[model samples]
Target chain A: MKSAAIAPGDVTRYGLGLAAPLALVFAVFFIAPLAQLFYLSLHNDAVATVWGLGQYVKFLTDPFSLSVLGATLLLGAEVTLLCLVLGYPIAWLHQRAGHWLQTVIILIVLLPLLTSVVVRTFAWIVILGRQGIINSTLQSLGLISTPLRMLYTQGGLVVALAQVQMPLMVLPLITAIGRIDTNLADASASLGAGHWRTFFRVILPLSMPGIIAGCTLTYAAAITAFITQSLVGGGQMLFMPMYLYQQASTLQNWPFAAAISIIFLVAVLAIVALFSTLGRRARINGDAT
Target chain B: MMIDRRRLLTSALTLGAMHAFPGLSYADARPLVFATFTGSWEEAHKAVLVPAFRKASGDAPVVLDPMLSVDQIAKVNAAKSNPPIDVMLHDPGPALVAIGQDLVEPFPVENSAYYKDLIPEAQDPNGPAPFFQVVGLTYNPDTVKTPPTSWADLWNPDYKGRVGITNLNSTLGTGWLVEVARMHGGSEANVDAGFKALEALKPNLAAVAANPGALATLYQQGQIDISPGNFNAIQILKARGVPVEFVAPKEGAIAFKTTIHIVKNSPNKELAFKLIEAALSPEVQTTLTEPPYLIVPTNAKVAMTGEIAKVLAKDTDELKKKFVFQDWKTINQQRASWIEKFNRDIKI
Candidate 1:
């Protein structure tokens, strides 16, 4: 066989061949529909025959639309924060657990995702209802005279959404924490750094990519979660997805729905961007130190 | 340049939607897709209506695709060119929208046999209603000592935390708003009175379930004693061994007409018409109005002997007199806003 050095053009050709399928798939599935949604957003009617930014203008100007957007952001942020605060320790434990124990722990974390969201929401309703298990147990224990109203409350909805989204947060954190070189943590501890100090300085900083991934995924899912929010919040939550459904299906206003969808997409993208920028700045600051 | 881009994107999106719809290009003896309810309604159609339809149409095959009315309408809206749905079974609320959007083909009166026998209210320009879902007070007889007579009784302090109301997305929900509006001295033209009345009932309201299944759960669990629900739903619950009773309130109840419309550009228009005829047939109407489904038949000729006749509205004129029917086209225009206000105000 003749010895041949691969040229730059050959390498470029190989790379393009490797990327072609993915590029085609992305164009077919993602970019095309996204463009279509944007186009649909511009029109003032359902048929898409009418062409203008009237629907977008209306959505932007409507107080109801604005409030729904606010609620969506609030819910997404709250769920993401809750997941981070609760998931970190769980992920840390899973990272440190024995092989069999880690498998069991991972299964527990993923069990909720395996179950139907509707089923889970309904279970929450049963657990949190006035005459539910909690109330019954409390009453039996003589904790209070009156049954506490937990179902249909904002707090109750947060609990349900957080429960469903916890797995998403935990799995990413586990991956990030597992990837962390334990030797660095051991080095920090050997150098007389305490547990909390080593974790804050070494472990958490190393897990930034995972944190960002988990938060982005959880927040995005939480914002768009229609069934859990509607069932748990009892249609009183008025989140963006529910509002979009009302606009699209109930009112038969496809244009308004498209506008709201775009707004939701932009809001989510902005949050993700903000997180990425903050992470980058923090990493730069850490490098300087 | 921008206009061309817009047109191109628009065309691409429109083309994309053609793929979004379920496959309609199929070869069958009776190639038709009928969209209606799931569970018992679907079962009833399969066991009773489908066979009756086959016999009525000389053994033409029919396919029943079960979905909620809202979803069916959405499917139609998404695929305007050729919706996979050939026959749509929906409430008058969505039917009106379908008509306004020109998504439905007008009933072929020349093709229908029992179209004239249908009640005048059912004989809509959009489509004839095969059955009626009368919105009345449903209560567990075991829980409540007093039998509530009027819609205003929902506001009574004794029934506090016992009454159930549907959220604004449902037909019963909007109907409740309209009914309350009229009760509180507001007409269809202005439902400001409706919102106020609804807000007033907030304290008494035990649950604001979005669908029949949820409402039924509330009743089954004894979380609710009374609520405004449909006649069919109440009967279905009763059949399931729930101790429930239906009453057409003294102030009158809301009657939602469940219409069957033929989709425009459906390949099975002839078969669809034949199926509609079978649905409106006396035997089929009786089957629909009987035990499991318990829907009120719209066929004027369908003689109800044992149980259904006692529950059904007296006549089409009586239905008009007793229940408030709003122009759904007008109602739809404000539906999104009304739902928003409803969600905001009616905090259960």
Candidate 2:
């Protein structure tokens, strides 16, 4: 008993000592800069001579700014939802496929991750442009006379973002679904339950943790993806990342940009928190059953 | 000397620290760092200006740090006491901002050999412009047939859903807006008429590109047949066999002075001045104005020739008559709000 108690304490202390170097690095690089950013955001003016909460007030009070925030959040939710819907079936297929087929599926999912996001975004632009593959094909088939505009539209942005962030959703789900006992599904079906019922009761509830993790990853990435967002969405679509860039880089309004960043960070954190809370409740319900 | 573990670790850490904080090793007297614009400008300077500067300064060590104007400002502002950049190149809008922020030293005009040789517009005591970036209409010659002669041609009913533009984030976009406002009886102080003109341009609009660079890609993709484009950028695209043509609008092409300055408190002030001087020299300017580069020269002494003379001007007098220089001082003041308004209103 004495050894067991001492071992736990000793291991924790050793673990902390091992992590000390990284902690110091984090404090020096990340925390210090973040603190400075927070300090800078407190200023009222562009040059940051006057100190106040004016920057925050400017963002919060302005309806246009709030709409940009809302649109960005909505964009994340749309991309995440699309990813989950598309990824779930692939994860399920991955779970059921033969070994060779499983390798092929995994390759397809992981292929996009190998190439840079820029290459992928540019590929999307080519795919969606006027006189592009889709338009030419459609025109040849007599499906449409004029080419449809798709490149810079909201729909195109969502589709492009969904494809870009799909790996984040799929990878977590593959691991989560793979963790399930195969016999449980058989048992679920044998108990007078249909395939849909078994999936709902046996598979999805068990994969709650993965869903939450994937949603969190995809949501954060889809919103903060500056390059993909700007390239795919064009100049008119004002997202949080581009808004922040315009202020900080173009206007030289660092204080306002800092304030925008802080607000965006909090907003994203709150959504992640909500996802985890939902996961916790689902876990509790599963335990009760 | 026997190498021990502790001694080896100590020396490794010291080396690493020195690498991380370069100030520890070279406290002063680093090479002259010139922050030139990226892409073709970097290539042009690396080829022509650097060689000229080296020859003038008796082969002094110089480094070309290529970046955007705003990035250069941010970096110099961060280290005002010991600025990393000895020299900076800027567009008209950012030149005013850098000057306002007190980040640049006034040009020593009296000492310069070629300051007076520059056109009157390029001569600013804050920092003289060595080059001019002309903005005009770029179009697909194969599709448009007759070349676009005026900015008004962008809104032609026949070219519906074929015209593209960029938002007011870039110097190109903002300057174009001011010119449009001027066309519609508004000035730098008010752009309401410009906004009204844009509203009427909605039917013809195909894309509102993020920047001037993206506008080129749109042309390549055939997404837009015509748009307001930078002269040099269009040349690069045309060289790549993109079937594009640049024509100065009847209203006169917008001429943005690309200014060079010595960063305040730069360690290599003399070398910085030498680099700017080399940039201002007619020999270097004429070389940069040639094929592939196609940079418009600001020096009155550099005789125009090749593609620049054919398309832009044959001499300084014609160039002045054809080029429209907007008051960037007035434009910079209202730029932020205009960008905001664009963000709010410009949705097709």
Candidate 3:
């Protein structure tokens, strides 16, 4: 016997029941504040602020904001690329190797993530600082006359971002690649494709979706990250979050901070779109079978 | 029926929001969440300010949010309308900014006579917030054998690479700069020669420390020797047996002052008012000047002897003659440009 179809009125009632509470919570916490943010972004609320596009225009035109947006994109891309380059190797090794080897690899990647961000960043600082382990080692080994300036540099940012986001890249890639049939790779090899050819033509193409997904996640996280960037950059690293924090707090310019946030949101979405487009093209070229 | 539903929801919303807020009278009794820069204020609030506030309000505890000055400014700005910090202990610059932006309300003076207790510099014409000075040089005695007699000696070649200086952005840094300027026959009016002198000492300098305590700790472990830092930091460090020495240099030690202004749109105005009063009360100010950390007292009533320092210049008169303090407001106004130039000019 078939169950009776749900009535339109019942569906409406059910939808309203869920939507109303969600709308209420969002309205109170997220939406209302966001509405205020919109207002702030548009107008000066300082002297009983009236709505104008001055703040938005200011944010759009600001050189510092542009540089921050640029840096954010670059850092995000670097982190994602690093995750792809480094993560795939670890993930592949884990898949091929025995359970004990896989455990060791898993532990190694997860170790930094398991630690607090603050602790991890501090560890990096210690390793990268002038008087830190890296410098001391370099000095003891007679690598150079003076200590190398490694910390508070973009290179440092990439290293840290890569380390932090590597797990993000690895876990997903592993999940996707591990699920791929081992027989397909073997068959491709038997059909005379070299190991390198097999990796590029078969495995790499198959793992594109996972790679894209992982890269997108990493880029978003790395770009928006505040604490790691700030610590590593030494307050001089003028990232978007740092700039946003300063404008809102130091300058007492809420409108400016909101406007900057809007800019950040736009940039992050643009990056995700750019990468996802690449993923879409890859999906199209790869064929349904 | 539609009208009834809308009206019911509207009424419910209004009531719900209102219920979240305190009733008008007891609103003043709500806990005033306050913050001060970490260091001496930590001990002062924990050991003294908290217990007294608890005693006064019975249930309205002052939540202590400790922070660095820069971080404090950032956090307060983040939570302005709905401020997590109801009251903050800010230095002259931020206090000035707070007053300028109307972020803080004026203090309510119950008695005009009691207001006379503030030093000439502490008096502010515009707001209820007054200045607090932690005068005297903060240094580690164990690191320095002679215990630096003058500001000139801080630039000595022996103490190079072990000397800690304040960030050029802060009053403490400018204080060191101004003293060196006067020593090299320059005035606060022209800080060029002084900045040059400071730049000259840069090769020997350690990192520009964020707080006096950091400098003191480095100095305590014999990692650093000179930290021409804060007054209270020296006191707190000495109290903790860090072997830190506080004295006036011959060119006059720079006196750094910070003003405390009540926040304008505070949830606990009455309690905030009371806390300020109690903070400035004799009971509170005295503890800030106890043995080992015997800081100079602003209150005419709080007794501070000249015998506080155990070094080169033992007496207060001799100390005052040597380390003359500059006008803070004058220095604070021009700090942004000066610090920017200093950062560009100095290597460390």
Best model per TM-score: 2
i-RMS for every candidate (Å) is 2.1, 0.8, 5.3
Q: Each prediction's TM-score against the native?
A: 0.87, 0.94, 0.74
> Which pairs in model 2 have colliding backbones?
none
Q: Which ten residues in a row have the lowest lDDT in candidate 2 chain A?
A: A1-10
Ranking by lDDT: 2, 1, 3
Sort every candidate by DockQ, greatest first: 2, 1, 3
> Model 2, residue A62: what's the lDDT?
98
**Candidate 1 residues A113-212, lDDT tens each?**
8988888888888888877888889999999887776766778888889998898899999999999888998999999999999988888788888898
- DockQ value for model 1: 0.32
From the highest TM-score down, the ranking of the candidates is 2, 1, 3
Pick the DockQ winner: 2
Q: Please, what are the lDDT tens digits per residue for candidate 3 over residues B166-271?
A: 5454556666676777778876666778888877887666555433433444554444567676666666666677777777655555655555556777777777
C-alpha DockQ of every model: 0.32, 0.63, 0.09
The TM-score that candidate 2 achieves is 0.94
Per-residue CA lDDT of model 2 for B190-252, tens digit only, reads 889999999999999889988898878888888899999999999999899998999999899
Error of 1 at A143 (Å): 1.6
Chain A TM per prediction: 0.90, 0.94, 0.87
